[model samples]
Target: MAFALPVWLAVQEELLAYGGEVDPESPSCFDDFDDEALFQMFHLTRPCIAFITDSTRIRMKKVALKKPTLPVDAMVMVTLNYYAHGVSSAAIQQRLRLSQNDCLSIICTVSGVIAGMADQFISFPLTRAARTNVALKIEKLCGITDALGVLAAAHFKIRASPYEKDTFRSFVNTLGYTSVVSQFICDSDGNILSVEKCCVGSTFEQDLWESSFKGREMEDELHGQYWVIGGSSYNLSKHVLTPVSEPANEKENRFNQAHAKIHDVMRITLGSMKRRFRCLMQLGFAQEGSLDKKSNIIKACSVLHNISKKFSVPPPPVVGKIEPLHPGRQHSVPIQINPEALKARQELIDCNFSVASSRQDPPSETVTEEDL
Candidate 1:
C-alpha cells in the first residue's frame, strides 16, 4: 500500500527542518516516522518523481540546443530607443546586459533588412488613370482650379537644386520606379498632382517666376528681375524689384536693397550646394572631376546666365573683387568682363555712337556746288 502522506510535508521535513525552524504540531514533525518510513513514503510516489525529472531534463536540453537567434527584435528596440531618447549605446548595453559587438551586429543586420524591404516595396510608374484621379483629388483639397500650380510652388523650395534632381533619379533607378521627378507637381493643397517629367525643373526659382508671369494677365506689371554675378567661392545671383507706384528716385534705392538680399541668399545656397556635392562625390555618386576654383567660377557664371535667361533678366557682371590690404595701395581691382557683359557693353557703345551721328546729321546739312 502506498504511504498516505503529502509531498509538501516530506519536502518541508527534509529541507526546512534543517534550518532549525519547524512546528511541532505539523505532520512533518512526527517523531514516530524514521528515515526508512519517510523514504518509503516518498518512494510510493514514483510517477510524480519521474514526471518532475523528465520535465527538468527536457528544459535543460532545450536550453543547450536552442540557437541564438541574434535577438533581432531586441536590437531594433534598443537602437530605436537610443535614437529617440538620445541614450548612449553603452548605457543601453549595461541595462540590457548585452555586449557591444552583439548590439552593433543586431543593429546593422536589422537596418540592412529594413533597407532591403523598403527597396522592394516601393513600386513606380503609376497608371495614367491613377495620376488623373490623384490630380482631381488634389484640386478638391486645395480648392484651386490650377492645383498643379500650387503643387509646383510647394515643391519649388525643396527640389530647386541639381543635387535633389540627382538624388531622385538615383532613388527611382534603384527601385525600378518609372515616375520622373518632373512629372510630380505640387497642387494648391500641397498634394503631388499628376506625374509628368516636365515638373522636374518647375521648382527652380527662375522657372516658377517665368511660369507665374506668363500665366498672369500682365507680364509687364511684374517688378522683379534677377541676375548672376561673381565667380566660384564668391558666386552669387542678384535680384532687383521696383514697385510700380514708387518714384523714379526710389527705384534705384529699392534695387540696391533687393540686390543685396539676393546676393546674400545666393551665396549661402551655393556654398551649401558645393559642400553637399563634395560629400556626394566622395560617396561615389559624383565623378571626381576638376572642381578647382576656376571651374567653380565658370560653373557659377553659367548657372547665373541660365537663370537670368529663364527669368528674362539681364545677366549681371561676373566680376571678381580684389581688395587692397594696405590703405596706401591702390583701390580694389575690377576683374575682366564676362562674355555676356562684354557683348552688352559693345551694344551700348554702338547705340550711343549712332545717336550722336544722328543728332549731328539730322538732314540739316546740304552740300552746295563749290565751283558756282
Candidate 2:
C-alpha cells in the first residue's frame, strides 16, 4: 500500500508547484511593517529593500534553477534577516517556510551578489581634486584642515574550529577572542571611504595599515597634502596624524581635542554599522562554512551599511559590546614613533591652533559708526 507523504514534504511540494510568489505590498508581507518595524525586522526600510531586489533581480535570476525558488524579494529578506539578527539558517527556516538548505543557499547567493556591489557605495577619493573635495568637506564639518578621514580598526569575533588554529587564534587582540580585523577610513560625516578586511585577528593594526594599498598611496602620492587622523597605536607618518602622546601646553591640548573629533566620527560609524547589522557583532557559521565565507558575509554587510546610511535608515536599539570568548589574554604592541612627523604636527598646530592665530584681533579696537 502507498503511504501518504509527510505534512512538511507535502507543503514543500505544493509550494514548488506554485512557483513561489511573495506579495510585496500585502498586509502579511514585509510591506505591512511600518518603517521602524521593518527596520527592526530587516535593518532596512521597504523602499530600500525594494531597491536592493530590483538591482539584484537580473543576476539572481541568472543563477541556475535546480529547483523552484522564492521570489527575489523573499530571498533578499531572508539574507537581510540573517544579517540583522545573526541567526542561523535553521532559525529562519520555518518562518520563511523553506528548508534550512534553501535558506542557507539563498543567504550565500544573495550575500555574494550584494558584496559585488561594493564599488558602487564604497570608494576612496583617488584623484587630487577628489581628495581635496573630501578634505574640504571634513574641514567644514570638524574644523580639521586638510583632514581626509579617520583611520580605525574594528574586531568581529568568530568561532574557533579544530582546524586553522594559528590563523583564528585570539592571542593578538586585547579582548582575547578569535576575530577578523577590519580597518576602515571614514570621512567627517561617518561615511566609509575605504575598508580592508583581509587580515585576521592576530595581525597587528599597524601592519594592516602598512600593507594596505590606500595606506601606501597616502604615504607616497598624497603625503603632505592630506592626512587621516588615527589613534596613538598607529604609526605616525606624514599622512597620519596621531594625538600628542603628552600634551605639553594649551595649544597642544587644544590640538589633541580637535584631532579627537575625527576619531569620534569613526567610532560612531563603526558602532552604527554594528548596530544595524548585528551579525558583525558576533558572526555565526555552519560547520561547512570557512573563514572566506565569513569574510564575504562581512563584506556584504559593509555594503549594506553604506546603503542604509545613504537612505537615512534608523539605527536599531543599542546593544552592549560582544563578550570576549577568551578574556584575560591581552596583548599590546609598541608604536614606532617618527620624530620627523612630530615637526609636521607641530607646524600644523602653530599655524591653525596657536593662541595668537586663534584669537580675534581684539574685535577691532576702533569700532565703526555702524557698531556704535
Candidate 3:
C-alpha cells in the first residue's frame, strides 16, 4: 500500500514525465480542470496542440539521451506559455521546475521549430481558382468587389537595447518603447499569406512594402482586372487603391466610403491576430542575440493564427488601436511610372463611382487595404 502524492506534486511529476501527445480529457498543470482554462493557458485547444506536435515532433525528438532533459510535450507547453505570456526565464523555470538555461534554450529551440514548419500551414494562394475563392468570401463580408486581400501592419512592442541603434524609432518616441515591426497580408478570413518581419520600429508600412515581396511586383501581376487596397498612409497606384485625401468631389467621397468597408475587414482581422497571441502584446526587451528569438516567435504566432482560424477556434476580442505616425522616409528615390498601371487605377476609380451611382453593393469584395 502506498500514499498518494500531493495534488501539486503529482501534477509536477506528470508534467515532467509528459511524453507522446496530450489527451484532451487528461489533466494539465497549465490550467484548471476546464476547457476555458486550457484555452487561456496556451491560447490553443487540445486538437491544435496535437496538430502542431505531429509536425514538429521529428525535430523535437532527442536521440542522444536515454532520458531527455524534458519531454517533448512539456517542451512545447513551456514554449507556448513563454510566447503566450512574454514571461521571464526565471518565472518560467519556477513554474515548470527547469533551470534558467533550460527554459531559455527551450524557448529558442521550440520557436525555431514552429517557424521552420510555417510553410505547411501559412501560404499565399497563387492560382486563380484559389484566389477566386478568397475574393468571393471577402466580398460577402465587406460588400466590395474584385478584392484580393487585406494588407495591414501592427507593431509588436519590444524593449530597446541600451545602445539602442537597432530599436530606435522616431515615430514612437512619444510612446517611449521600441518595436520590431511586422507586416502581414491575409485573405479575408484572416489567414496570413505573406509576412515581412524584423523591420525596426521607425519603418512605416509604406517604406516596409517597397523593400518587400509586394512593392513593385503587384502592379505587373495585377494589371487592371484585379486590385489590392490599403489605407491613406499608402500612396495609391494603378494596382492599388486608397481613400480620397480630401474628397474633392462626390465621386471621391463615394470612393472613400467604399474604402471604409475594407477598413473594417482589416480592423477585424488584425485585431483578432493581436488578441489571440497576447505574447505579441509586448514581446519583452530586445538585447544582443535576442532579435532572432523574437522574430521566430512572431512567425510562429502567425502560423498558429492560421491554424486556429482553420480549425474554427474562436478568435479573441480585438483590442488596441494602430499607432498613427509616419514621419515618411528620410531621403527619397523617385518612383517610376507605368502606363498600364495608370489605366488600371483610372478604371478602378470609375468602377467605384459606378457602384456608388447605382446605389448598390458590389458583387465582389476586391476592396483590399494594403500597399503590396
Question: How close is every model to the real structure, measured as TM-score?
Answer: 0.24, 0.77, 0.75
Taking all chains together, the TM-score of candidate 1 against the true structure is: 0.24
How well is each residue in 34-111 modelled by candidate 2, as lDDT tens digits? 877777678788766765665455434444444436766678878888898887545456667987678778888888
Relative to the true structure, candidate 2 reaches a TM of: 0.77
Model 1: residues with Cα > 4 Å off, grouped in runs: 1-69, 86-91, 120-125, 143-372
* lDDT tens digits, residue span 1-372, model 1: 011134324434544433423343433211233644422322112222222222222322333424335332344444333322223246557756878677655544433333222111221213545335433543232111111222111111111123655645432321233111121222222212221222321133233333542223113423222112111212111221211122244333333332232223223332222221221111112221212222222222222222222223221122343111111111135434246534442333344322333222223332111100
C-alpha RMSD for every candidate: 31.4, 11.8, 8.9
Model with the higher TM-score, candidate 1 or 2: 2
Q: Cα lDDT for residue 258, model 2?
A: 70
Clashes (candidate 1): 10
| Count of backbone collisions in candidate 2 | 0
Off by over 4 Å in 3: 1-33, 58-68, 88-95, 162-176, 216-225, 287-290, 317-342, 357-372
- Cα lDDT tens digits, model 3, 1-372, are 011124223433443464544355554454332668667666778666655554455434422223446766677777877666666445556767887678778877778888875665677666788777767766565445676776666667777755666434432422455667776777665677777666666665677767777655676564234567677656666555656667676666656666776555666665566667777878877754447877888898887777677566775543455434322333255555456655665566676565455443553544332311
The best candidate by lDDT is: 2
Model 3 poorest ten-residue lDDT run? 1-10
